[model samples]
Every structure is written in structure tokens, then in C-alpha cells.
Target: MTYLANPTRYSDMTYRRCGRSGLQLPALSLGLWHNFGGVDTFENYRAILHTAFDQGVTHLDLANNYGPPPGSAEENFGTILKKDFLPYRDELIISTKAGYTMWPGPYGDWGSKKYLVASLDQSLKRMGLEYVDIFYHHRPDPNTPLEETMAALDLIVRQGKALYVGISNYKAEETAQASAILKQLGTPCVIHQPKYSMFERWVEGGLLDTLEKEGIGCIPFSPLAQGLLTNKYLQGVPEDSRAAKPHGFLKTAMITPEKLEQIQQLNALAQERRQSLAQMALSWILKDPRVTSVLVGASRPAQLLDSLECLKNTNFSAEELEKIETILK
Candidate 1:
């Protein structure tokens, strides 16, 4: 069956400007980090993408090393784009990153110009895109000079491989340096992707302040803290959950008793707000105006719909905020 997008897809979602850039990203962007790989069903993956787009998710985030086997997510997304997203290309913002281990040998990873340039080329080929909307250096490389990495990003933009450039997993000092270099290169770093959630507040210490001063947008990954912030683990680990999976990042050992207790309290707070724990978690991130968007990953379309509900009630009163802080503390 041919897929048709909803006519009112843009009605409910809010778009925020990405830093000082002219680009405006959807408040909630869909990420293909988990279940869109080759091991997953094509029909299910395609359904999630279609459902997200139809509900006004214009930004789709991917990484060159997203798949278990590596590069499979981009390949699968490429096929789906050719099939369903081609007509709406201009209306969507597609992004992919590099700087992680992708292939054998020294040139395959890190922030060197050789690796970043090659990785993005491969990503574009996989996604069948002339140029990605945003291309990011996946992480900082201690060995590589910051100048070289920023120069590579600037060159990619000049070469038309990407419209905007960003950096991920970089600390405050590194971000400030990279942003300065990119600014000098005339391709100001437009966004920063970090891991931020109620359970993870590393960004609050300095990254958020640096981004605001540098004029870079902030899009937090792991906003659900690898499903720890959601209601899924409140009753203990389910056999089907990520924590139960042997090879996944969220291990069973990480789910401590104390963590579960905190989750229970937060879940109660979510219930009072008439929202799911996941929704409240996401809403808490969106409560900050500095947050350009929250990147969400899902194994199914229903999960994506639940996350979209975060948009409906983002407001939090003084008491709710204080209680949430107390629980998190």
C-alpha cells in the first residue's frame, strides 16, 4: 500500500529555532538509534518512521554506527526514504553523525578530517541524500586537534555534504573551543547533542550554559535515561526490556533498588500530572527554553505517540518543580 502523510501533521507540534541559525527543528525529533537496524523487521521500522512523520516529526536523527552491525540503520532508513519520504524531502530535516568506530584501520574512527569526511560520504550514500540537513562529529577525539575537526566540518558544509554542522558528547570547554573555531570558519556550530534526563543532569553543570552563550542549540539524547526514567522499570525489569537484553547498553546491574524507589516516586508525580512517566520526563526537558529539541527512540509507533503527549502539557508549577528536584536529589 502507498503511504500518504496526514494533512494536519504540523498542527500539534511546536518548532524551535536552532540557536542563531535559520533552521527550526521540531520540538520532538525521532531518533533511529535502537530498532531500525537490519535485525529488526522492515515493516515495523517503516511503520514507526511513517507514524512519526505523519504526526509532525520533521527531524530524524541517525548515526553512521547506529546498527549493531554498523551502518545498517542508515541503509534501512535510505530504503524507507526512497519509498515514503521522497516527496516530503524539503519539509524534513535529516541528520547523521560520525566520529565513532565504523570500519577497520586507523582512518575509520575519531575526529580526524580523513575519518569524518569519509564517514559522512558513506552515510549520504546509504541514505541516498545529496546533503544531510545536519552532520555532526559524534564525539571528541583527544588526539586530533580541535582545529582539524572544525575545519573538516566547515569543509563539509562548503562542499555541500551538509547544510549545518554540530558536535555531540563534547564537554563545555571542548564545545566552547569547537564553536569558536567553527565560528571563525564561518560555519557556526548550530547544535549540541548531549545526554540529559531527570536521572542524568550533566548538562546543567556547564554544557547548557556554554551552549547558550555560544549560540548553539541543545538536543538531548537519552532523555529517558535508557528507559530508566520511564514507567517500564518501576515494577522491576521485564524480560523483554533493554536492561534484560544481554548485549544492550542498559544492563540489569544498573537498575539498583534505590533507583527503582526514586522511579516509583516520580511515577506517582507523573500520575498526578495525568501523564506517563516517559511523558513527564520528556516534558521536564522541554520545560527549558534552551532545549531546542528532545531526541526520542522507540521500538514501536505507540511509544512514539506516548512521547508526543509531552507536547500537550509541558508546563510545571513551582511545587511540581520542587518536588521533582527533591525526588531526583
Candidate 2:
């Protein structure tokens, strides 16, 4: 059977402008970081993608080194794109990042004109994309001069390989500098992807203010705190949970007894708000005007649907905010 996207996909989901740019992303964007890798089931990720698009999640975030083998995620996405999403390409916002260790030797990693240019070329080939909606520098390269990196991104845009450019994992000062450089080169930094959630609040320190000042949109990854902020951990770690896995970003030791207690407390508050803990976690982030959208990863379609439910109730009361702060404390 052929896959046809739902005609009513945009009827309910929310879209926010990316900074001052004309691009508006769904409130919840799908990230192909973990589950869509070469190691995961194709049918599962395919269903996840279908469900995401059916609900107006037009933004698909990716990185060159996302897969366990590196580059496999893009290959898989390219296959899916060719099969299911080709006709709707104009409506989608596909993004990919570089700046991490991708291949080998000197030119394989970091932020250099040669590396970024080559990496995006490889990424374009893998994803079957003539140009990505957004291309990003995955992280700040201490050894690479900021001018070289920002110029490379500008060049990529001029070459028509990327419509917009952004930076990820960059601090306030770095972002300000990068934004300035890109602006001088006649391409504004449209967005900034950062590690942000209730548990991870480093962005609030200074990054958020800088992004706002620079008029760059903010899309936070790990908004669920690597699944810790969800209800699954409130009772105890599930046998199938990320904490139970021997390998992965979330370690078992990180889910301490104290952390479990906090999860329980947060879940209780979520219940009062008539939302799942995951919803509250996402809603907490979306409540801010500075956050254009949030990057959410789901292993299954149902999980993606549950995460999107956060859209229904993004408002937070003063008491609720204070209580959450106390619980986090």
C-alpha cells in the first residue's frame, strides 16, 4: 500500500517562527539521533516518521555521525525520503550537522572549511538531498578559528547546498561571535540547537539571552532529559528502559535513588496538570517564547504521539513553576 500523508496534518499542531526568519517549525520536531540508526528496525522508524509527518512534525533533525556506524541514519532517511517523502519535500524542513569526528585523519572532523564542506557533500549524497533546509555546525571547535567556520557555512549557503545555517552546542559568547560573523557574511544564523530540559538548564544561564538578542530561534534537544523526565522512571527503572540498557547515553548509575525521587515528585505535579510527565517536561520548555521548537526522539510511533500531546497545554502557573523549581532543587 502507498503511504499518503494525512490531509489534516496541520489542523492541530502548533508552528513557531524560527527567530526572525520566515521558516516556522512544528512545536515538536523529530530527531533521528538514536532509534533511526542502522542498528534499529526499519519498519519501526518508518512508522515513527509517518506518524510524525501525519501530525505536522515537518522538521527532521539529523547529524552526520548519528548512527552507530556513522552516516547510516542519513542513508536510511534518504531511502525513506525517496520512497515516502519526495513529493512533500517542499513542506519539510530537513537539517543535518557536522563538526564532530566523522571519518578519520586530519580532515575527518572539527570545524574547518574543508571538513564542513566535505562533510555536507557526503551528507547530501547520503540523504539524497540537493540542499538541506538547514545545515549546522555540530559544536564549537576550539582549534578552528570562528571566521573559518562561519565562512564555510556562508559558502555552503551561497553554493545553494543549504538554505539556512545554524550552530549547536555553542555557548553564549561563541554564539554571539558566530552570529556576528555569519551576519557580516550576509547570512544570518537562523537557529541554535542546544542541550536543554528541566534537568539540563545551562541554556538559561546566558545562551537563551544571547539567542534572543541575536534573533536566533532555539530548538532544544534532550528535552525529556534522555527519558528521565518521563513517567516510565517514576515507579522504577523498567527492564526495557534506556537505564536498563548496557550501552547508551543514559547510564544506570545516573538514575540514582535521589533522581528517582525527583522524577516521582515531578510526575505528581504533572498529574495535577492533567498531563504525562513527558508532556509536562516538553511543555515546560515550550512555555518559553524564546524556544521556537523542541527536538524529540521516539523509539516508537506511540511515544511520538504522547510527546506531541504537550502541545495542548503549554501554559504554566506561577505556583506550578515555583513547585517545579523546588522539586528540581
Candidate 3:
């Protein structure tokens, strides 16, 4: 079947500028962290991608270590890009990251010029991209000098392997240092990806302030707190849910009684807002002016479509915010 994009795709969704960079990203960018691997159904993810773009989700995020076997997400994304998204390439913001163990031996992992450069080359080949819209160092490496990793990012940009550079999972202090180095290198760290949600508020302590000060846009991952913020577990864990899965990051044990209560309270609030628990959760993150985007993962096209509804109502009253804070605490 031919894959013609929605003509009015830009009508409903919103785009925010990434830091001080000329680039802007969709409020809800799709993340290929799970369920787009070689082990998953290709049609399923392809359909999700289609639905995402149709709703103005122009940014697609990926990591070199996304798949269970590693590198398969990029390969699958490559196939879909060639098949359905070749023409719409100019309208998309494609980004990927490195800085994890990809292969055997020391050179295959961490933040080094050799590892980052080689990993990105492999990533480009897998995605069939000449250059990604943004390339990120997936995490901070305590063992490696920060300058080396930042320099590697600058080098990739100079070589035209990436249009912009970013850092992920880095703390506030680390982010400030990295951003300073990138600024000196003339690359200017444009974005910061952090694990933040109602459940995980570490970024609120300092990261968000640092990013704003450094002129780096913030895009938070795990905005739903690994599905806890969603309505799926309000009743209890479902057999088919991520928490029920033995192999995934979300474990059954993490769904304690207290967590369920918080989920239920939040669900009640979501109902008042005429939104789903997931939608409200995402909206909570988007309510922060510092957040440029929120990266979400979807297992199905319907799920992705459901997530897009968050954009419809992201505002919360002062009372609502106080209630949410009380419940979270």
C-alpha cells in the first residue's frame, strides 16, 4: 500500500524551538526504545510511525542500544524510512544516541572518540541516513573525560554526520560542563534528554534550571513513569502489561500498593479533566515551560494516537497543581 502522509498533519499539534537552536520539535516525539526491535512485529511499529507523523509528531528518537539485541531498532526504522517516509524526510527530525555497550571489548562501549564515531557510523548505516538531525551522547561516562565526549560530538557535527548534538541522562552539573564545552567547540548543546515524570522528579531539583540557564532545551523520557502514570494499572497489573513482563524494565514488584493508590488518585483527576491518566501525566510534563518535548513509546498505533490527545489539554489550574503535588508527595 502507498503511504501518503496526512495533508493537514501540522494543524493540531504544536512545535517548540529546541533551546536557542533554529530547530523546533513536535511536543510529543515518538521514541523507539521498545517494541520496534527485530523481535517485534514490523507492521505494528510501522503503523505507529504512520499514526505519529499523521498527527504532527515529526520527531522520532532512537538509541544505538534500543533493541534487545542492540541496533535492530535503527535497522527496522531504516526500512520504514525507505518504504514510507522517504518523501517526508525533509519535514522530520530524526535523532539517535550512543554511549552504551554495543559490542565486546573496551573500545566498543562508553564515551570515547573511537567508540562514539564508530557507533554513529554503524547507526547511520543501520538507519540508512547520511546524517541524523540530532546525535546525542546517550549517557555520561565517569571514566572518560567530559571534554573527550563533548569533542567527539563536535567532531561528528563538523564531519556532517549530525546537524545538532545533545546529551542524555546527564545530571545538572554534568550537563552544565558538557554544554560549556560544546559551546566552546561551536556546536552548542541544543537539547538534554532526562528521565523525568511525576514519579521521578530528580530533574526538578536542579537539571531543569541548569538546562534553562545553559540555553539547552529539555525533552524528558519516561514521562509516564514506566506506565504507572497511565490508567492501565489503576485496577491492578494486567497480564499483558509491561509490569507483568519478566524481561522488561518495569517489574511487577515496583507496582506496590502505595503506587496503585497514587495511580488511582491521578486517574480520578484525569477523569475530571476529561482525559486519560496517560494523557494527564504527559500534560503534566508539558506544563513546564522548560520542557520542549516529551518522548513517548507506543506499542500500537491506537496507543500512539491516544497519547497525542495529551496535547489537546496541557494546562492545569493552581488548585489542580497543588492537588497533584500533594498526591505525588
Candidate 4:
């Protein structure tokens, strides 16, 4: 079926301006970090992508080293792009990153002018894209001169290979420095994608203030803390959950009994509010004006839809906020 043929699909998920940029992204963006990889089943990947788009999730996040085989996720996602999402390319915000270990040798990774630029070009080819909506420096490279990395980003934008540029996993001070460099280069940094959730409030250390002061939008990834904030672990680790998956990002040790107790209390609060833990986790992050979007990864279409519903109950009363903070404390 054509992506637009489903009339009910467009009724859900809201779009918000990415900071002050002209681009508007779905409130809940889908990420291909976990599933949609080499080991993941294709049927599951296709269903999640199709269902997400039909439900108005127009933004998809990808990185160079996402899959177990490094580039397999982009290759797999590209297949879906060519099949179902090709026709709606204009309506989508497709982003890919480079800066992590991809390939081998000196030029294989990091933030050198050589590495960042070349990785993006390879990413464009792998995803069969003429240009990506946004290209990100996957992480900060202290070894690489900030000037060199910023120059490469400026060149990519000037060449029309990417419409906008963003940074991920950068601290407040580092982001402020990069934002200053990009601002001077005429390619002002537009967004910052960070890992934020109730359990991961490390960004509050100053990152949000720095981005806001710099006019850079913030999109938080893992708003569910790799599914830790969800109900999946409230009882025990499910057999097929990320915590149980062999060599997954979420390790079994992370689901300690103490952590489970925290999740249980949080889930109780969520239940009282008539929302799921996943939704509450997402809503907690989105409560900040600095957060422009929540980058969520889903293994199933139902999970994607359920997360999107978080926006519907985004408002949290002062008491609720206080209670959450106390629990988190």
C-alpha cells in the first residue's frame, strides 16, 4: 500500500520546529540504533518504519557505525527508503552521523577534516542520498582541531551535501566552543542531539543552557534510557528485551535490583497519572523547552505509536515534577 493511502495514519504525532530552524520534526523521531541492524529481522524493521511514517513520524536518525557490522543499518534503512519512503523524501528529516569508529585505520573514524567529510560522502552513497537533512559529528574528537572539524562541516553545507549540521554527545563547554566556531564560519550550528531521560539528567549540568544561549536546538536521544524507563524492566528483564539481547547497548548489570525498585516507584507514579512509564519518561524530557524533539528507538511499530502518545500528556504539574525529582534524587 502507498504510504499516504492510510488515512488514519496522519492523524497522530505532532511536528515541532527544530529550535528556530525552518525544519519541523515529529515530536517523536525514530532512530535506527538498535533494531533495523544486521542481526535484526527485516520484517520487523519494515513494519516499524512503515507504521511510524503512517503515524506521522517523519524524522529518522541513523549513524555510520549503528549496526553490528558497522554500516548494515544504513544499508538496510536505505532499502526501506528506496521502497516506501522514497516518495515522501521531501516530508522527511533523515539524519546520519560519523565521528565514531566506522571501518579501520587512521582515516576510518574521528573528527578530522578528512574523516568527517569522507565519512559523510560514504554515508550519502550507502543511503543512496544526494544529501542528508542533517549531518552530525557523532562525538567530540579532542585530537582533532575544532577549526578542522568546523571547516569540514561548513564545506559540506556549502556544497549542498547537507542542509544543516548538528553535534551529539558533546558537553556544555565543548558545545559552546563548537557553536562559536560554526557561527564564525557562516554555517551556524543548528542542533544538538544528546542522551537525556529521567535516569540520565547529566545534560542538565549545563548543556541545555549553553545550547539555548547559542540558539542551537536540542534533541534528546534515549529518552527512555535504552528502554530502562519503560515498563519492560519493572517486573524482570524480558527474554527478547534489549537488556537480554546478547551484546546489546543495555547490559544485564544495568537492571540491578535497586534500579528495578526505582523503576517500580516511577511506574507507580505513571500508573497514577494514567500513563505508561515510557510515556512518562518521554514526557519528563520534553517538559523542558530546550528539548525540541525526543529521538526514540523502537523494535516494534506498537512501541513507536505508544511513545508518540507521550506528547498528548506532555504537561506535568509542579507536584508531579517535584515527586519525580525526589524519586530520582
Per-candidate RMSD vs. true structure?
0.7, 0.8, 0.8, 1.5
Stretches off by above 4 angstroms in model 3 are none
- Among all windows of ten consecutive residues in candidate 1, which has the lowest summed lDDT? 63-72
Q: How does each model score on lDDT?
A: 0.95, 0.95, 0.94, 0.87
For model 1, residues 21-114, the per-residue Cα lDDT tens digits are 8999999999999999989999999999999999999999999998866999999999999999999999999999998899999999999999
lDDT of 3 by residue, 1-329 (tens): 99999999999999998887898999999999999998999899999999999999999999999886699999999999999999999999999999889999998898999999999999999999999999999999989999999999999999999999999999999999999999999999999999999999999999999999988999999999998898789899999999998888899999999999999999999999999999999999999989999999999999998999889999999999999999988
State every prediction's TM-score relative to the real structure: 0.99, 0.98, 0.99, 0.96
After aligning candidate 2 to the native by TM-score, how far in Å is the CA of 301 from where it should be? Answer: 0.7
What value of lDDT does candidate 4 attain over all alpha carbons?
0.87
| lDDT per residue (tens digit) for residues 1-329 in model 4 | 54543556557667777766787777888999988889899989999988888888878999999886888999998888887888789878999999988878999888998888889898888889999999999899989898899899999999999999999999999999999999899998889999888888889999999988888889998888888898888888999888897877799988888889889999999998889999999888888887888899888888888888788898999999999888877
Cα displacement (Å) at residue 77, model 3: 0.5
Model 2 vs truth, CA RMSD: 0.8
| Candidate 1 TM-score over all chains jointly | 0.99
Model 2 TM-score is 0.98
lDDT of 3 at 77: 98
Q: Which stretches in model 2 have alpha-carbon errors above 4 Å?
A: none
**Residue lDDT tens for model 2, 1-329:** 57899999999999999999998999999999999888999999999999999999999999999987799999999999999999999999999999899998999999999999999999999999999999999999999999999999999999999999999999999999999999999999999999999999999999999999999999999999999998778888899999899877898889989999999999999999999999999999999999999999999999999999999999999999999999999
